[model samples]
Target: MTARPLGVEIACDGPTGHYDCPHNAAIRAQFTSRTARQVRADGRRDGWRARPGGLDICPDCVKETTR
Candidate 1:
């Protein structure tokens, strides 16, 4: 049996409704190969929450955290 690829979910603490955020797009592009487990682990380590869904991150939140 083949393992299904889990959809990546982003749990942002900032503003909601980031469906059009470019940073979210970049994240999707950047971690195209990252498994759901990996993303969850990283989120745990970074104080964020990663689940399985169609969640997204906004550009302002990205700038605030990454800076």
Candidate 2:
């Protein structure tokens, strides 16, 4: 079976915002090595949550938020 890409949970500051966010992209790029443990640690440090599943931010969100 194919393994799913690890996803990081970008915590909502106030209200439930779009999943696609620059912060999420930055974090994912920063942790492309797939060191989930380290990613999680870093996420916690950065006030985000890195975990499993398809929680990665979507491209639309990235475009909208980044712009």
Candidate 3:
């Protein structure tokens, strides 16, 4: 039997990115924050990018970029 994902993950959007099983991207998008920082924090909590830009990068990609 094949294992199915419980929730859709928000993948990293660096130079190269792929689907990841981290969190529910849909739920993450439903969240709303008053401040940019808070927005970043929320996104971060969902394994999404916290940086300010049109593009997004997952936590794993963040580590790769920082390195």
Candidate 4:
């Protein structure tokens, strides 16, 4: 997942290397303060990306789900 940017902080356990997973992507978007969003997998090798949602509370929402 590619995030425009964010200003929030997040801690992941499953995947922390790439900003793809909807969970992680949410963090990057919320924390980094990203606007434009898009989630596309180039191929099997590539993972998923986070696209823009109607709301802004994303990463935080992810954290809540994990809990």
Best by lDDT: 3
Error of 4 at 40 (Å): 9.6
**lDDT per residue, candidate 1, 1-67, as tens digits?**
8997556654453534433543343233125436655555555555443324545344455455467
In the range 1-67, model 2's lDDT, one tens digit per residue, is 8999765534322112433354444443254645655565555455454224435334434344456
How big is the positional error of residue 56 in model 2, measured in Å on the Cα after superposition? 5.8
**Among all candidates shown, the one with the greatest TM-score:** 3
Error of 4 at 62 (Å): 0.5
Per-model C-alpha lDDT, please?
0.47, 0.44, 0.52, 0.34
Worst 10-residue stretch by lDDT in candidate 3?
A: 21-30
**True-vs-predicted CA distance for residue 16, candidate 4, Å:** 23
Q: Residue 34 in candidate 2 has what lDDT? A: 59
Model 1's TM-score against the true structure = 0.30
lDDT of 3 by residue, 6-28 (tens): 43334345534445424323324
Better structure of 1 and 2 per lDDT: 1
Candidate 4 Cα RMSD (Å): 12.0
lDDT of 3: 0.52
| Regions of candidate 4 where Cα sits further than 4 Å from its true position | 1-57
Question: Candidate 2 clashing pairs?
Answer: none
